[model samples]
Target: MTSMSFADAARICLTAKYATFSGRARRAEYWWFSVVYMIAAVVVAGICLAAGSVLPGILLLLFIVPMLSVSVRRLHDTGRSGWRMLIALIPVAGPILYLVGMTVDSVPATNEYGPSPKAVGQPVG
Candidate 1:
C-alpha cells in the first residue's frame, strides 16, 4: 500500500510489521507503539522460558512483525531512507547510526520518501 490509515497501520503492526520490509513509516506511528511491544516481548520471553512454560516462546514468534515495524518507522522519522536501515550490517556503527537516526526528527518538510505524512492530514493520495 502507498499509504496506511491509522487503523490499517495498527493492524499492520499486530500482523506483519516484523515479516517484510517495505514502504515508508512515520515516526509517531512506529515508536510509541514500539515501546509497548518491547515490554510485552521481554515479559513474554521470560514467561515462556520459566521452566514450566512454552507459551511465551510462541508469543515471541508471533510478535516479530510489530518489532520490525517500529524499527522501520523509527528510521522514517529520522529523515533517512528506510532502506538505510541496512546500515546495521556494519556492526557497531550500524546500531549507533540507527539510534541517532531514530532520535532525529523528520527533515522539516520532506525528502525522497514522498511528501510529508503531516501534510496529508486532510486526505492521503
Candidate 2:
C-alpha cells in the first residue's frame, strides 16, 4: 500500500480497523485519530445535549474499541507491549506515562510485536 497521509491514516483507523488490536500504528496515525476522536466526542456530546437524548452516546461506544486498539498498536510501535496500556489506569500519573510512551518515536527496526509502521516495504507480521 502507498504511504498514508495523516488524514488517511486516521480514517483507516476509525473505519477499516475499528476494532483491530494486533498491529503497529504510526505516531501520525495515533495522534490524528486522537484529535478526531476528541473533536467528535465534543460534537456528539453537544448534539446529545441539544436533542435531550442518549443517541450520541452510541457514537462514543462505537469508538471505544478503535481507541483502545489504536492505543495498543501505538504502544507496540514504540516497542512496548500492549499490556503496558494498563498504565493508563493509574489515575493522573498513569495517563501521563502512557501519553509519554505513545509520544516516543517508533523503534527503527522490528521488535517482538512486529515491524515499524513507518517503514516502507516491510511486512507487518
Candidate 3:
C-alpha cells in the first residue's frame, strides 16, 4: 500500500473526518495532522499575544473535536477501543502510556473498527 501524503492526511483530518470518532486512521494521517495542529496552535498563540485577542482560545475550541476524533480513530487503528483515550485523564504516566498507544503501527488487517486504512491496493493519495 502507498503511504498517505501530508496534504491528504491534513485534508482528511481537518475536513472530511473533522468530528468522526469512528473508523481507522493511518499513522501518517494522525501524525501529519498533529504537526499541522501544533504549528497552527503556535502561530495562533503568537498572534493572540501580539494582538491581545481571543484567537488562541477560538482556535483551540474549533480544533478540539477534530483532534479528539483523530486521536480516537488513531487508537482504533491500533485495534484499541476509542474509549481507551480516557487513560489520558490520569496524571503523568497515563499521558505517556496514551501517547505510546498512539504511536503503535496500524493493524495489518481489520479489527472491529472496519478494514485497515493502509490495506494493500487502496488508493492512498
Clashes of each: 2, 0, 0
Q: TM-scores for all candidates?
A: 0.63, 0.87, 0.92
Which candidate's TM-score is highest?
Answer: 3
Q: Which stretches of candidate 3 lie over 4 Å from their true place?
A: none
| Ranking of all predicted structures according to TM-score, beginning with the best and ending with the worst | 3, 2, 1
lDDT of each: 0.61, 0.82, 0.86
- Model 2 deviation from native, Cα RMSD in Å: 2.6
User: When superposed on Cα atoms, how far off is each prediction in RMSD?
Assistant: 4.9, 2.6, 1.4
Per-residue accuracy of model 2 over 1-42 as CA lDDT, tens digit each = 345566776677778888888878888788888887898799
Residue 68 of model 2: what lDDT?
91
- Candidate 2 vs candidate 3, lDDT winner: 3
For candidate 2, give the lDDT of residue 97. Answer: 94
Pairs that collide in candidate 3 are none
The segments of candidate 1 whose C-alpha lies over 4 angstroms from its true place after superposition are 1-12, 15-23, 51-55, 77-79, 120-125
